[model samples]
Structures are given as structure tokens and as C-alpha cells.
Target chain A: MLSMQKVSFRYGKNTDYVLSGVDADFVPGKFYTVFGPSGSGKTTCLSLLGGLDTPTAGEVLLDGISLRQIGGEELRRKHVSYIFQNYMLFPYMSAVQNVVTAIEISGKGGREAKQEAEKVLLSLGIEEKDMYRKVRKLSGGQQQRVAIARSVATGSRYILADEPTGNLDKKNAQMIIDIFLRLVREQEKCLVVVTHSQQVRDASDIRYELTDGQLSLWGEAAEYAEF
Target chain B: MRNFSTIAKRAFRTISGKWKGYALLLLVVAAITLTLYIFFFWLDASARLATQARTSTEACILLQSNDRQQIGSLPQAMREHPAVKGSDTTTLLTASPVNFVNAVSRQDSPFDLPGESDQVLVSAHTDIAMSDAFRTGNASLVEGAFPTGSDPQVVIEDVLAKRNGLQIGDSISMSLSLPGYTEPHQLNLRVCGIYHLQQPIEATYYTSDGTPVYGASPYSSVFVPFDTLAVRFPDALSQDSVCFYLTDFTAISSVLEQFRQLNPDPARYTLSDFTDYRYEQLLQASQAVGRLILAAVWIFIGMELLILFFAILSILRSYYKDAGILIALGERRRCVAAQFLFQILVVGVVAVSVTLVGAFLLTPLLATLASGQIVHTAAETLPGNAVEIGAIENMARLLEEHGGNFAMLYASIAVLSVLVLLGLSSFFLFSHTPTRRLFDKE
Candidate 1:
């Protein structure tokens, strides 16, 4: 389980807090989504969960150990994976290479890594020919699939995505949502996705809304909630 | 846990993906390398030539005296002086032209002429072979040998021998007026050798009456064994100059002081100043130019390194997104930096290789150009006969032998500069910029 305990964040010393005393728990075999308007710190919440950024206050723990004690790099490399909203695939690498690199960075490489990358990319509906082309040459939906494939190929326990389908069309977004559901059900992985899309929020098993520097369950009072 | 091969493979991909930028960098680095190598070559060749010129040119001190005993004993004294390691002394004497047989004029006469209208003026020396012309290869034996033994053997100039129809076995007769003799002394000398003068040198001598004779051409002179001449005419006036072959020409003042100590009395002996000051000055000027070239090389390297630093910084900035992606994917920061380092190293190796090959191909041409410049400078600054083409050739040969080493040294420096600057720039870019900021568009 990856959990954020009383987390608070501010950009700098004099800035107002973006997240104040917020708490959340992400467990395996569950699909969760955090939805909010602009400036609600939804991406900041996901970044903290994935060890991409350290919380200014409070602790992020993986399986009851503090993220700091586990070391951010080691936690990210061994237990967590991320899918950025912009689909930050290495621009110079092909789709398959991007997936393969993530797997290699996760400490599984060689011929098996290449085979696994191609399998994951193909399962995401990316064609064999497009997998070898640079990601910049791929379409928006294809790039998102490649990004998802990169996260899934690492086989980490926690998959933290910031707007996984923000740029995708309806059909691609639904496919991505279905992939997330299957990852949670069949693979028993923890999926925490931050998005503004109602479709993503409705499809998830658990949902929360971030507003005014507080996190609350959907349809609940606008106050920080501990879960 | 990333291995070197994995990092290297990723680095190779990055390099090949952005080959255009790396290609431009290679070209810039190669141009800088070539320029630096040329400056180094110039400095090395100039220094070597200056040293050759300093060591090869003869530095001498002329010694003159009216006392025969003092002047005659001076050679033995100078030979024993610790300062004169390779020194040689030659006593200059002039033969009277009265009743001197003209070998060239005798060719037209069937009978012997006792008093020929054309007289052969002769200058005798203790060691005629030690003159500058002979030492510097300006004069060579044409048919006969130098007079070495204590015989009345004479070596005449080729021009005189040819004009007089003389051969090696022929004899020449001269009449000398000695101080102790009441009548003129007649002597017959065998023509044992003949020498050709490639360049005529003006010689000065003192007559038996101590009269200074200037503008005497070697073409009209003959070489007789000094012991034979001195023993035959003990009162013969001679002009003697001691040539000191110093181990270090720069310490000439100390050697001159030693020479002065040996012959202190100004009334009996006088020493001429060392005559090769211009050559020494030229060497010093060459050394100054060498130093200037070295300074210029350092400044050029500094400018090139600055350009390289900025270029690397720009590359890292452009690749910020890639770095963010790699870091997000769990690649260590040092591993990412190593990727970029390997990228720059690929280009550095290529540039260094190209520079080595270019330096090899251009060495002869550059050496020739350098030699021509040195020779031209030497000709302008030195006396006409003092400029040695052999010294210039030696400089070129030395440049060839050591030019490759110089190029290798500079190539190493170029590669090392790229590595050091890349490491610093990587640290600056990676250590200061947060991973989140790397994803920012700016």
C-alpha cells in the first residue's frame, strides 16, 4: 500500500500551500481517481504518491516505510511507475524502445525486456510498424498507449498517472479506462489516476475531489478527509 | 545497477539520433585542434632552430702581438686553458712578393723567368684548414691535399694552378728577405695540392715589418707548413688569432675573461671582441618569438574551451526533456549524466582522430613553410656567408621527427578539455535543475 499522511505542499517558502494536511491511502487491487478543477493540486497529489516530488510536510510511506527511508529513487524504480499527462516519452526513442528502457531501468533487461515491451505495446493496440517509429511521429492516442505500456511494462505495484487519457478521444479514453480496470482486477495492482475527466472519475472504483487545498470523497463535504 | 554497455548503448542511440549537432561540434573541435597543433609546431621548430644556430656558429677571439715569443707561446697556453676545450689557434703570416714565381704566368713562357712581372702574393698559416671557409664547407680540395707535414710543400689555389698549367708534382720557387740574412733567401716548394674556393673570403695579415695588409683575397694565397715557414724565417711577422670552441656559447664572457687573464699586458697582446654577437642576438629574438607563440597557444586553448563549454551547456539544455524522462523512468542522475558524457566523448574521439590524420598529412607542407620563413629571417638578419641552409634543414628534419608527438599531445589536451568541461557543465545542469523543472517547457 502507498499512503500519503497529513501531506502539505508549497512551491516556495513564501507561497501559500497547495495541499494542506491532506491524507490518502492507495491499496493494491483497487482503481482510484482524484478529480478537481484547475489549481486544485491534483497533479501535485499524484507526484507525491509516485515519489516524483517530496512533500514539504508529512510523510509518504510505501508498505509502512517512509518514502524518504526507502529512498525516492529506489521506491520509484522498484515499486512505483508513472504516466505523465504530456506522455513524456523520450522523444528520440521509438515507442518500443521507450517501454524497453523503462523495463531496463526497473532492473529487468536484455532480450526478455525487448520481447515484453513489444508484447505490451501490441496489447495496447499499437501496430508492429508504429512501435519502431519515434514517439513524436505517433498520434496522441498512440503516444498515450505507449506511455501506459511503459508504466505497465515495469510491472511495479503502484501505477500513478496524471491525466492518463486527458488528450485521448472518447474511444481511446474508454480503452485506457478498461486497461486500468483490468490491471487492478487481474494484475492486482494499485492505480491512482488524477484527472479532470468525468468519464475517468465515474469508471474508477473509488473517487475523491480536491478543492481549496483539501481532499474529500466525491459528493461529500469540501473538507480534508482521511482514508 | 546500469552497466557500462547499457549506458554506452543508450549514449550511442542519443548520439546517432542527433548526429547533425554532434557533427557540427566535431567540425568545430577539429578546426580548433588543427590550429592549436600548428601553433605548437611553430613554437617547437623555432626553439630548435634557435638552439642549432647558437651552437653551430663559431665564436672566436682574435689575439695580436708584436712580441714573437709571447704570440708564439700563446697557442700552447690557450690549449691548456680549461675554458678552451676545443679551441684552435692559427698564426697568420704574409710572404713577400719579390722574386715570387707566377705559376699562371709561367704557362706562357717556355723558359724559367727569374723576375716575373706578375708575382704571386702568398699568405702562410700554421693551420690553414681551420679557417671558417674550410670549417663551414665553403672551400674544398679540388685535386691535391692540405700541407700537413714539415716539408716545403705548398697548396696553391685552383685558379692559380689552372692559369699556370701547374700539376701536383710541379715546384714553385720564391725568394724571401729574412731579417738575419744579408742577401735574399731562395726556396723551392713542391706543389703538393690545390684547393678550390667556392666563396672568396677577404683575409688580413701582418708583414715581416708588422705592417697591416687588408683586403687580401684567398684566391692569390698559398698554404705552406707553418713549422717550415717559422723555422726558415724566424723574424717573419704574423697575424695570429685564437679561435675558441666553447662548450657553451652563452658563457663567452667568462671565457674571454680567462683569455684576458692569460695575456694581461696590453702592451704586448691585444684581444679582439667576440665577433658573433649578431648571431646570438638572432637566437635570442627567435626564442622570444617562440615564447610568444606559446602564449598564443594557451590563449587560443582558453577561447576554444570557452566555446566548448557553452556548446555543451546548450546541448544539455536542449536535451532537458530527455533527461527528465530518463530520471522519471528510474535512471540514476549520474547515469543520465554519463549518457551525455558518452555522447560528447564520441564526438571528441572523432574530432581527435580527424585531427591526427590531418596533422600527419599536412606536416611536410607546414614544415616546408616554417623552414622557408626561418631561412628568410636568418638571411635578413645575418651576414651573407653566415646564413647556413643546413641549419634550416636540420630544423625541418627535427620538426618532422617530433611533430607527431606534439600533435598527439595537443589531441590529448583537446579530448581532456572536452571531458572536463562536459563534466562540469553536466553537474551544473543536472545538479541545479530539479527533475520537475526539467519537464517544464522553459
Candidate 2:
């Protein structure tokens, strides 16, 4: 479980906070989404949860271990994986090679890593022809699928995605939503996604709204009381 | 842990993708290396030539033999010594060449002596002295012949003979003036030959009267056989100096050392050889030229390094995004550094190999240009008959023997500079570009 305990953040020496007094908990077999408009610190929250940044105040804990103590690079490499909206694949590499490289970085064996990379790419609706083509030559939907494959290939328990389907069309976004739901429900993985799309927010198991550096649970007392 | 295979694969692909940049870098490095090689060859050749020129010249050794032990046997000793080519002996006196010429003409106070100096009178007694005289075109027997021995006969240079108007068979009287002697001792001799010389053998010294005088050339002096002079002034004819010419010029120092061991007292016996001194002078001149070449070589190398530094920096700057991506993917900083280093090492090794071939072809052209200068400078100080070409060729052979060091240094510099570039590139990655900014762009 990754949790944010009374977490607050500010950029540099500014007086106003980008995120303040925020509390959140993420667990396996559960899908979490933070939805808000621009300037709502939605991506900032994902950045902290992904271990790409540290909160200026309060602590972010991973399985009762501090994210600050584990170090961002180590935590990201071993426990959490991030996916960006733009799909930051290496332009020079093919879709399969991109997946393979990510898995290798996550410490998989060479032969097994390549096998897993191909398996994930094929499952994500990437054809054999497109799987071997350079990422730059791949279409937007195919590139986003490759990025999803890369995130899943790492096998990290927590996936912190900042608007994973922001650049995808309806059908591709729906497919990505299915993949995320299956990962959370079947694979028993915790996924924290930040998005403004209602379909994605409704597909998630729990929802929170962030506005002006403040976070609030959105469901009614009985409907969300189990949390 | 880094997956080295991935880094290597990526490095190769990156190089292939940017082949033009790597090619340009290789050419620049090869050109710089070629320049260094040319200078090394030229400087080495010039230095060897200068050393040979100075050491191969004629050497003169001065020695004092108060007792006739060493002096009497000097001619034979010099002739038998393996290093000696030729030798001659001379004696100085306070007697008069003018008085002798005046006596031969049967006239007193008729004209001023033409070849006379107000210095101590000096004459040499050697049969082979004519070898130097005739070979130099300085003198030849114009009338009659050279004396067979110290047979009471004299050969006078043409200038002295002309002023006195003396015939070849005319008898002359020479007198020696000693400070404590009751009367002047004299010897009567007949003139055997009269030779003309453009430049003559001259010696300078002070007379018993303490009058300083500069000596005149041998063309203005008298010469005779040693036995007759010894008979006439037995007490005055001690051999004070002997000069030896060596067959091998390089053996001069060792022979001089042997002479020192023979005569150890510095005050009573003074010795000097010009070979070592001349060698030092030539070495200093050559070293000055070599220093200039070294300076130019280093300046070019420094310029090449600056170009390399900026070129690598530019490449790294363009690859910042890639490096940041790698960092975000959980690649260690050292892994990123190694990836960059591998690429640089590949380029550097290829460039150095190309330079080796280029330098091999270019060295001969540079050496030929320098050999002409080597010969010309040698001719300036060496005798006219000396073989300047042979000395230069010998220097070339010597360079061939010692050429490996420069080639090694060339390779070493290429490798070391590449390592430095890699280190700087790694530092640039760690300190100049940040991974957080890479993800923020999305």
C-alpha cells in the first residue's frame, strides 16, 4: 500500500501551496483516480505518488516505508511505474524493443524479458508488423499501447499514470481502461490514475477531487464508507 | 546494475544514426596526429644531423713535453695511434726571420722585411706539413725542392723570399737571442725551396723583452728540418707542442683522456680539444630549433584538443534528452556515462588507426624537406672535402633506430584525450541535465 499522510507541497519559496493538507491511500486490487480541472494539482499529486517528486511537507509512505527513505529512483525502479499521456518511448527503438528495454531495466532476464515484451505488445492489440516498427513510425494509438506495455512490463505493484489516455481516441481510451481494470482486478495491482475524463473516473473503484491544493472524497458517506 | 549489452547496442545505433559527426571528429583527430608525427620526424632528424656535424670535424690537441720522452716520440706515437690521421711539430724562438732573409740577400738595412711581425719568431719542422699546404692550395715548391731532412737547408714562403730578393741556393744565417747568453747563437743554412700560400700558419706570443706582437701568416715566415735546428740550438729545441689529426673523429675524446692520464699536472701540462666544445655549440643551436618545433607542435595539439572538447560537448548537449530518458528508466548514472564513453572510444580508436597510416605516408616527405637543411648547415662548418650527404644519411639511419617512441607517444595522446572527453561528457550528464525536467516536458 502507498499512502500520502497529510502531504503538502509548494514550488520553491512561494507563499501559496500547489498541494496542501492532502490525505490519500492506495492498495492492491483497487483502482484510484484523482480528477480536477487545470491548476488543481492533479499531475502534481501523481508526480509525488510516482516518486518523481517529494512533498515539501509531510511524508509519502510505501508499504509503511517512507518514499523519502527509499529514494525516488529506487522506488520507481522496484515498486512503482509511471506512464505519461504522450507515451515517452525511445523514438529510435521499435515497440517490442521499447518494452524489452523497460523490462530489462526492471531486472528481468534477457530471454525472458524479450518474451514478456512480445507477449504484452501482442495482447495490447499491437500487430506483429507494427510491433517491430520504430516507435516514431507507429500511430498514436499504437504508440500509447506500447507505452502501456512498457508500464505493465515492469511488473511494479503500483502504477502511477498521469492521464494515460489523454491523447487516445474513444475506442483506444476504452481499451486502455479495460487493460487498467484487468490489471487492478485480476493481477491484484494498485493503480493511481490522474484524469479529468468522466468515463475513466467512473471506471475507477475510488474517486477524489482536488481543487486549490485541497482534496475531498466525492462519494456519499454510506457509498464510500467502506474505505 | 546496468545491462551492458543494451548500452553497447544503443551506443552503436547512435553512432550509426549520427555518422557524419563521428566522421568529422575522426578526420580532425587524424589531421592533428599527422601534424605531430611530421614535427617529430623533422626534429629528430635535425637534432641527429647537428650532433654528427659537430663531432666529425677536425680536432686539434695541444700538449707540453718538457723532457723529450713524450715530445721526441710524439710523431711516431700519433702515426701509430688508431685514431690519428696525421700530425706535425713546431718550435717557437726569439730569433729573427728578417735577419735571416737579410743575410741571404747579402744586404743590411736595404728594405723592410715583408713577412715580419714584432712578435717572437716561430717556425715548424715537419716533412708532412707540405701535405696541408699543397692540399689547401696555400703553397707549392716554386723553385728547387723540399728539404730531405734537417740537412742545414731551409724552405721560405714566397712573400719573405720576394722582399729579400734571395736566390734558391743563397745561404742565410739565423740567430737566436737568449736573455742571459753572452752572445747570440747563429746557424748558417741554404734555401732549398720557396712556396706561395694565400693563408699561412701563424703563432702569437710575447718576446723576452715583454713586447706584445701579433704573428704573421706562414707565407711571411721561414721553415726548416728539425735535426739541423736541434744541432744548432740544442738547449732551445725542446718539443713544446704537438698537434694530431685523427682518422676517426668520434675517437677524439677518448684519445684526449689517454693524453691526460699520460700528463696529469694541469699547470705544467695544459691540454685542449675543440671537438667537445664545437659539439656543445652545435647541440645548443639544434636544441633551439627543436624547442621551436616543439612549441608549434603543442600549439597545434592544444588547438585540436579544444576542437575535440567543443565537438563532444555539442554532441552531448543534443543527446541530453536521451540521457534523461535513460536516467528516468532506472539506468544508473554510471551506466549512462559508460554508454557515452564506449561511443567515444570507438571513434577515437578508428581515428588514431587512420592517423597511423597517414603519418606513415607523410613522414618521408617531411624528412626529405628537412634533409636539405641538414646538409646545408653541415657544409657551413665542415671542410670543403667533407661528405655532408654521408653525415645526413647516417643521421637518418639513427632516426630509424629511435623512431618507435614518437609513434607510441602519438597513440598514447590519442587514447588519453579520448578518455578525458568521455569523463567530461559523463560529468556534463550528471551535473548539467536533470531527469525531472525530462518527464516534466510531457
Candidate 3:
């Protein structure tokens, strides 16, 4: 489980706080979504969750260890995988190579890592023939799948997706959402997706609304489902 | 991974992948390397010639004139000096047109001369035993042996011998005519020895044949016993023709000063610092041309490396985004930097290796080009015979004369060029911030 307790963060002096005194708990086998409009610090919250950035004045605990205690890079490397709105695949590498890079850098199996990466990509509907092509040549939907494949190959417990469907069409967005939910339920992984889509909101086991750096329960039914 | 070989290999791969970016730069570097190689060549050759120059240290002081009368009984003066140990004087006035043939039979003359002017060849004559010792004190021996014993013997110069095929055990006829005798006095003598003495005299003299040879060298004159010369042509010399051989060079000035007080002819007595008299045209000529070529090579190479740097910088900059993405994917910054570093090392190793190989392959051709089809008389100093302790002693003596060294020209150049190239490379390139340049591509 990951929890941020009364976490308050601001960009600079006298500037509006991006995450103002927010508290949240995330657990395995649960799907959570944060609903927010533009400038709602949605991506900012995802960065905090993945330990990409530090809280200005509060504690973000990974299984009772505060984010302050664990180095952000070590925390991200060992415990969380990030999926950006832009896919973030290495442009020059093929889909397989991109995923292989993550596994290699993470110090997992060597050549076996490539086999594992391909298996995951294949499961995510990456065409076997197309997997050898570079990411730049892949369509947006395919690239998004490739990014998801990398996160899965990392094998971390937590998947922190920022604006998971921010640039996708409704059909592709829905397909991505279905993939995240299935990963949480079938893989027994923790899922934290930041989205403004009502469909994503309704599909979450627990939901929170972040507005002006403050988080409030989305509705009592959503919290009840998590418990 | 801490695998330096892998890093090096990967770097080489990257370098190879982008050859066009630095090809011209590489070519320029190669040209410069060739220049450096030639510089080293000259440095080595010059060093060798300089060493050769060092060995031929000058022994005798130059008198103001070739006229021996002004020395004022130097032979008696030197024989009388307390500090003097051993001494000889050979006058190098004008070379005689002497021809030599090995004494095949007693009925035939050992010398052959048809068309030549009669001339006087005056030089230091130790007594037969002393003449043997004096001839031993020289660096080169072209043919024949040193003369010993007073059995009517003389050693012809080797150049004179070569014209008629003379070697050891040859005899030649030579005689000195006194001032009043118009008829040349001839002495049929055993060719006890022949000499190929080298020196720095300016007077040009030759044998019947036209091959160039050192003429009128102080040591190049014919050798005979001091007694024989006096007995044969007593009037040719006087109490005035005395020469001194001072053992301790430091006492030369005082000895000269004493000689001046006794004899009053300034033109008759002048000191010759033989070292100053001799010049190393080969080494000097090499340095002059070598410096120009080597400098051009260096400048050309430095410019090429700079061009390579820029090309490499631009290519790596274009890959900055890929680098950034890799960093974000948890690749260590060092690993990212290592890739680029590997590439540079690879190119450098290849470039230097290629140049070295090329230079070694072309060594003969270059050696020929560097030095035209020139004749080099390779020489060394060895004893005339096992009993000739004078030669062994002279070798050590001449070794000391040259300050105990053999190759000054190339040694100085090798050291200087290496120092300069290393200094230039370190000054221009090491510690340059490669990362900053890559990042600044933004």
C-alpha cells in the first residue's frame, strides 16, 4: 500500500500550492482514479505518487516508508513504473528494444528479458511483425500500448499513469482504461490513473476529486467499494 | 557493468557508424601524423649525424699559417714541456698527386703517376715507432696498416691507394726535395700502412682520378720517422720549424703565450679550436628542413582534431533526446557519458594505429626521399692491430674528445618533438567538458 499523508507541495514562494495538504491511501488489487480539470495538478499528483518529486511539507509513505526516507530515484526504480501522457518510448528504439532497455537498466534477466518483454508486448496486442519497427513509426495507439508493455515488464507493484488517455480518441481511451483495470484485477497490481473522463471515474473502485490542490471524496459509494 | 572492453568496443562502434562526420578530420590527422613521423625521422637521423660529428673532435690548434717556420722549434719545445706526454705535428699545406699500387714485385714501382704537379706533403712524423703511434690516433682507416720500424717505409693515403688498388703490405715511392734541389728526390719505400684520414681543411686537392676527397687535413699528410725526414732533407726544416704537442689542453693558452714570447711572428702562430672549425651540415640541414615540415604536420593535425571535435559534438547533440529518454529510464548518467567517450577513444586508436602502420610500411621510401641517393660512409674506430695500443688508447682518447657521446642530433630531436606533441595535445584537449557541449545543444 502507498499513502501520502497531508502532503502539501508548491512550485515556489507565494505561488499556488499544487498539492495542498492531500491525503490518500492506495492498496494492491484496487483501482483508483483522480478526477480533475485542467490545472488541477493531475500530472503533478501522479508525479508525487510515483515518487518522481518530493512533497514540500508532508510524508508520502511506500508501505510505511516515507518518500523522504527512500530516495525518489530508488523508490521509482524498485517500486513504481510511470506511463506518461506522451507514451515516452525511446524514439529511436523498436517497441521491443524500448521495453528491453527498461528491463536491462533495471538489472533483471539479460536476454531472457527480451523474451519476457516480447511476451508482454504480444499480450498487449503489439503485432509480432510490427514489434521490430521503431517507436516513431508506430501509430499513437500502438505506441501507447508499447509504453504500457514497458511498465508491465518493469514488474513494479505500482503503476502511476499520468493522463492515461489524454490524447487518445474515445475508443482508444476506453481500450487503454480496460487494459489498466484488467492489469489491476488480473495481475493483482496497484493502479493509480489520473483522468478527467467520466467513464474512467465511474470504472474506479475508489475515486477522488483534486481541485485547487485539495482532494475530497468523490462520492461515498466509491470509497465503500475500495473497503 | 564496469566492463572496460565492452565500453571500448561500443565506443568504436559508435565512431564507425558516423565516419563521415569526422572523415576529413581524420585525414588531416593522418597527414599531421606523417609529418610527426618525418620529424622523428629527422630527429633520429640528425641525432645520428650529430653523434658522428661529436666523435671527430678536433685535436690540434690551428696555426695562423701553413708555414711551419713560425712555430719556432715546436717539436723541441713540446719534447721539452714538463706537462706534455705525447705529441705529433702533420703539416697540411697542399696535397701531392700521389698514386699507389700494392708492391707486386720489387722490379716494379709501387707508385704510378703520369700527369700531375710535384707538391710537398708535410705532416707529423713520429720516429718509426712514434709514427706508428701517431697514425693509430685517428677514427677511420680505409686500407693498409700503420707504419712501424725505420725500414724505409711510408703509408699512402687510402684515396691515393684506391686509384691503383692498394691494400696492406703495399709500398710506394715518395721523396721530399730541399729548397735548392730542382730534381725531385725519390724514395722507394715499403707500404707499411695506408691512411684515410678525414678533416675540415678548405684546400681542394686530388689524385690522378677525379673522385672528391678531403684535402690538406692536418692528419692527412704522409708519415715517416722524424729522423728520416731530417736525414733526407735536412735543409727543408730549421730550428724555426719546431711544433708542439701539448697533452693538457687547459695549458694551451699559457703554452701559446710562452711560444709568442720566444717567437715574434703573429702570422706564424694562431690557435685552431678544431671543434669550431668543423660543422655538421647534415644535421643542420635536416633540422632546418625537418623543423619546417614537422611544424606544418603538427598545425595540420591540430586543425583536423578540432574539426573532428565539432563533427562529433554535433552528432551527439542530435542524439541528446535519446540520451534524455535513456536517463529517464533509469540509466546512470555515467553510462550515458561512457558511450560518447568510447566513440572518441575508438576513433583515436584507429587513427593513430593506421598512421603508425602506414609510416612503418613507407619507412624505406621515406628514408630515400628524406635523403637523396646520397652516399653515407658508415664508419667506426677500431685498432690497426692487437699490438697497436695507440689505436685502443686513441679510441678512448677521441671518445673523451667528443665529451663521451656518439648521437646528439637525433636524440635532441626525439626528445623535443615528443615533449612538444604531448604538451600540445594535453593543452588543447584534455579536461574539455564534453557533457556541457552535449547539453547545450538545447
Tens digits of per-residue lDDT for model 3, A92-198: 56788778777766667557878999999999989899899878898888899999989888888888876667778989888888888889999988988887778
Ranking by lDDT: 1, 2, 3
Against the reference, the lDDT scores of all candidates come to 0.72, 0.67, 0.58
Instruction: List residue ranges in candidate 2 displaced over 4 A.
Output: A10-17, A35-41, A166-175, A196-203, A218-227, B1-6, B17-21, B35-303, B357-366, B369-387, B414-418, B421-433, B440-442
Give lDDT tens digits, candidate 3, residues B239-303: 32232333444456766676666656675545443322122333344455566666876776577
- Model 2, B308-372: lDDT tens per residue? 77777776765666676666666666777777787777777777777777666655554554444
Using Cα atoms with residue i matched to residue i, what is each candidate's TM-score against the true structure? 0.75, 0.62, 0.62
Better of 1 and 3 by lDDT: 1
Question: How good is model 1 by TM-score?
Answer: 0.75
Query: Which of the two, 1 or 3, has more DockQ?
Result: 1
Pairs that collide, model 2? B83-B247, B138-B197
Each model's DockQ score: 0.35, 0.18, 0.22
Query: Model 1 residue A163 lDDT?
Result: 83
Q: Is the docking of candidate 1 incorrect, acceptable, medium or high quality?
A: acceptable
How do the residues A1-227 of candidate 2 rate in per-residue lDDT, one tens digit apiece? 89999999986785689899798888989988888878778887877887667899988999999988988777777788877777777777888888887787777757898889989988888988888888999988888889888888888888887788888888989989999998898889898888878889989988888887987777752266656
The stretch of ten residues in a row with the least summed lDDT in candidate 1 chain B is B93-102
